[model samples]
Target: MRPLIGLDQVSVAFPGTLALDRVSLQVFPGDVLAVIGANGSGKTTLLTTLTGLRAPTGGTVVDADGPVRLRGPADALTRGVALVPQEPQLATSLPVWENLLIGHGGLRGAAPGRAARARARALVAEALPHVDPGTPAGQLRKADRAIVALLRAQSSRPKVLALDEPTAVLGDRGVEIVAEATSRLRAEGGAVVLVSHRLRDIVRLATRVAVLVDGRLVHDAPIGEVSVEELVETMAAGRPASAQVTARVTGERPSGGSAVPRAREHRLSVEVLAVRGLREHGLSVDELTVRAGEIVGLAGLAGSGRSRLCRLVAGASGGSAPVTFLGGPLPSDTRASRRAGIAYLPEDRANESVFAGLTVARNLEIADVVPAGLGTLFGPRPDRSRTARTISEFGIKTASHQTEITALSGGNQQRAVLARVLAHQPRLLVADEPTQGVDRTGRAAIHTMIRRFAESGGAVLVVSSEFEELQELADSLHVIRDGRVVARRPPDCEYRELVALATGARDEKEAEQ
Candidate 1:
């Protein structure tokens, strides 16, 4: 059978890096192609080239009909090829049914007439029978949002669906949702190209596996022909030399402050902030705290009030004085949070956390300068010595300190942001979806950073959609449902347990409520 889509000796280069080097790949009808690689191995570049999100620096892309000329996502989508990003920004305020007919994931300008609504309902029934068609995209659980995205794409019945790390932040149930959708697509003669680091996903859904090593197609074989062990070995062979760790963070707590919260009384000797009664914007937190040398995690589905609580704690203006930070009311603004020794990593890293236009060095140093109201271009040259040290300490892989942050992979960008946050030497770290889009290698590296920071007596509170991540990272894991702390378990809590509590899926009776 002819391939539905393919890359013919494609190459993508960014200044100092060859992101894709003469890589050739093909997706046949009914194919579930699994693409795996280590961090910065050009997995993303390959996907972008295939989907026309990025024009190849060299070579061409050919479809069954002929060589595709246009290099744009719209052209690809128009030709029945769509790439669903890792974090698909759906229209959260609109109901899932409407979003399926209008917006990024769906056919823009598709009238929401009776027939359109009928088609959307049929797709939802086929892919996500449990989800309500009318539920706002924001209110559905994380997994549901992901599934709805698939259904939205399926509405167009694309010839090939390219998914970028769809299951990275998901659990067993979430993965299964995508898996079932893939099966349904393949059964209908549609092809899927899955870019992921999870071996289980490759083993579970892929009809064929393709491994990239430093932008080259190093391995490609039928799923039945390879073993998991060999796949792991192949990817690891191409990993760059392990990143070096140069220095440890100073764990010393700054001298105590006398200002206390008048909102509520606190009994526990606080290490991080202690929230007694946090009620704002439909979220309510009765109690949550992290000791100086501990890591606490919050796990919940989408719209469960996880990010809202983190924002309030991170010193965004609003909400009651629900927290006491090192004997003072919680800092009320971003600059104050940094000044008070608190570093908050926002959930929307691409838009909120990192400055894509800035270089890696500038991104690292801006946390310090911005608080002082200095522009990156006009600011006194960043402390070159400290910038170098932070790069080494954070394992940020950039061609040079002067490299724009967007040039690097998602993992490297995330580590750079973490390094910038650490530049403030914060007492508490509030990280949301810290490892959201990174590969297994990057995930391990980030986990090490969080652990070391907590080991240094810096308190931490993490919010993650991935339950397994929270289980692995938190010393004490809290489950939030409909904005209340439903349960708290030790770090060893199982993924299913957290999923049940957060999703209200414990038992038939509980699921009803």
Candidate 2:
């Protein structure tokens, strides 16, 4: 089969970094090519090069029909190519319908009229059955935002579609929708380029797989020819074994009695945090508890109330739920939550967690300000020694602490954010989608940190869309559906069983059997 698009020895260079070096790949009609690699292995750059967002410094991009030079995203769109970025670029303040329509409008030469608006509504109805088109984009959950971005891309009916981590934040139903859409596109002779960290997604959607190490394409094969273990080994080639941190179940007591003992140990294991009669965003929980020295995981599909529960517990949003921390009543406010030793790691790190315009040193110092009140009244200065230790401990890769947080990769940024939150050493950690964009190595580091914290006697309540992740990291998993936790399973529960429960494919009774 002739390739719809081909890259011939393409190379892209920045001032000090060689982003892509002599990389070549082909996208054929009706083919789904999966791109797999470690973070910063030029996967994003490859997509940008194909979409004309980044001009190749060397080599040519050839079309089966003729020679082609993509000037920019606009040019690529004209040639029937579309890209769905990892971070959604929607105008949050605008209505969902407007964002979807505007995305489609950019591809068409003619301005959208009343007829076009009607067509867009029909498309939205067909593509997104659960989403409300009239709702503001800001009001939608992160997973919903991703869905909107994908549906908008589908609206253009491009011959070639490129998706970056589309299933990273989506639930099982959302993944099914995307898979169906991809199959339809393939049947219609369109090509797909998928970049994802989830092996299950790769197994379900990809016909072929390409592995990139550093800046080179190290392996390429049909999906049927390679096992998941082989793919993991290929991606972990350069990453050291020590760098991959696994969760540990320790037997020794925490130093300095830092962790409160669990009730099973003959001592009263007090609940560090508790919520009762909580209600928000149409989701309600009768009661929830996080005991000291425990890691409790919330597992559910996207938009299934996990994020909302995190926000409510963190006091980032208003809810009628009565929350208590360490025997004290808690208020519905962020500052109070922190003052009460509750630390929150938001899901949308780009917008809610990090200070992108500031340096890593400054971002870390924000933790210091939380405890000192006005002690550093003149000007807040970061503790250099503490920052250096944190950078090393968290395995955050940066030129220096002075480097801008924005300049780091997704995994590094996540590490930095996590480091800052842990610096405070709060009693209760409320983390949502903690490893959403991190790669395999980075994920291990994060898992290590969370486990260490729990072992130290601190309590953790984590929410993750990946059932396997929860199974590995959590001591117990809570399955949520339609805004309520319907089942609680041991960490040894099966992934497919958990998914079935979360999606209402099976009832709790059936799951138990």
Candidate 3:
């Protein structure tokens, strides 16, 4: 087949980073290309460039027949391209029908009347047979959100579909759904480019795999030629040394009765929060606790009140408050929660965390603006040296502390956010979807940071819709569904059990209703 899309000597340069450097690649009809890379490896930047959301500083992008003036996402869409961003945003007030139509080209201009309605029904049936067409898209789970997005994009019958982290928010079943969808798309002769950290998706859907390293394309080959471990190592090597070594030396503890004795002392104690009749869109909690040195994982489908609970605890949400920290109930305000040493890392990093135009040093210091030496804001104005050290320690890759945050890659931006919160050393850390946009190396670094926090007698309340993430990170797991915690289990909760709880499979109709 002739190439559907091609990049020749493409390069993208920001103030302090070269996001893509002299890169060349091709996409063909019926191809599923998995783009793999470390955090700062430019996967997103490359996608943006392909979709015409960005202009290359050098080289050219040829689409279908010839070189074209890449204008915007709309232009790319009209030319047979669509991108499902890392954090797919949807209009909360819109119904599933409207949301899907939004992708088709807004509600007003979309195909109208009974024929349009028939087409919408047909499109939904083809893409998501299980989703309720009349239901609100906001009411859908994160996995469903991804599925709906895919459906919306595919509804246009684009020649190429760009899905970024499509399964990042999904469960095992959701992953299977995406895999099946990819297979169907390929069968229909449409090319799919999937960017993801999950190895399973790549293995299942990709015919070819390409790995990027620090703005350069390092590995481009057939999927059958590489193993997951080899891919991981290449991506890891591409990362800065700090990110690679952050999780260094696990299982190196002294073996003896002292190690045995330490296990008993590792128990975490969670303070009781006001757990009375709390209700928000069907999610309710009777009681919850967060113990120091323990990782509490909240697992559920999207809109399961997992994120809402985090917001309530962080004092960011407008809800009835009985949430507590350190034996005292958390105040019904955000500042009070922060004052009590609870740091929340939001799922939407770009929107919720980091002040974009500021310097990296200043951004890192925002979490806790404490004076190092003189203990005065006016005197020496917060230690730049300490901020730089924190940046290095957290394995963030930046040109310098003075570099603009917007210039760094998504993974690096995430790393900088981690450095910011971890520097504060909060007694209780509430991280909501911490690894959403991060690569393997960055994920490992974040995992290490969370573990170290727990080891150092701090509490961690992690709310993740990704079942796999909860399974790997939580010392204990709780399943939230319909806005309430429906179940709890030990850290090593069986994946089946976690899924069962998340989907409310075992719960009676009364409980779910």
lDDT (Cα, tens digit) per residue for candidate 3, span 1-513: 677776888999986568899999888987889997644578888888988889999999887687876888888888888887767677757777667667464445755567766777777666668877777778887767777777777767778888887776665565676677778778888888888755656887799999887789888898999987577666655223221112222332222201111222455554523354565434577666777777788876554568878888777874355555566666566666666577778888888897988988888876655324335555345677898788878888899888999888777888888778777678878899888766666676777777777788888888764555565567667777656687777654445455445544456343342
Q: What are the per-residue Cα lDDT tens digits for candidate 2 across 1-513?
A: 777876889988875567788988889998889987654578888988988898899988877875589999988888888999977888899878777677455545567788867776676667667777777889888778888888778878889999987876566675697788799899899989988756667878899999887778888888999977677667656543321112223333333222222222211287998877766555667677888888889987654678878888787874243777887777568877887788899999999998989998888888877676765657566779989999999989999899999999888899899888888789999999998877666777787788778877789999886666676678778887767777888776555456556645566576553
- Which model scores highest in lDDT? 2
Per-residue lDDT over 1-513 for candidate 1, one digit per residue giving the tens place of the 0 to 100 score: 888899999899985568889988889988999987654578888888888889998989999986887569878888888887777668999887877787433455545678878888777766667778777889987667777777777777788999887874454565787777788788888899998765665788899999887788899889889977677667656322211110111222212311211111222355677888777656677788887877788977655678878888888754257778886788768787788788899999899988988888888877767566644566656689989988998898889999999999899999999988977678999998998788767877888888878766788999886555565556678877666677777655444455456544442244331
Candidate 3: residue pairs that collide: 274-322, 282-482, 283-482, 283-483, 283-484, 284-483, 284-484, 324-330
lDDT of 3 at 1: 60
Give TM per candidate. 0.57, 0.59, 0.58
Model 1 Cα RMSD, Å?
A: 11.2
Those runs of model 2 whose alpha carbons end farther than 4 Å from true positions after fitting are 9-22, 37-45, 54-62, 65-71, 86-88, 91-110, 128-148, 167-176, 212-216, 227-313, 317-331, 344-425, 429-513
Q: Would you list the C-alpha lDDT of every candidate in the order shown? A: 0.75, 0.77, 0.71
Candidate 3 achieves a global lDDT of: 0.71
Order the candidate numbers by TM-score, best to worst.
2, 3, 1
Instruction: Evaluate model 2: give its lDDT.
Output: 0.77
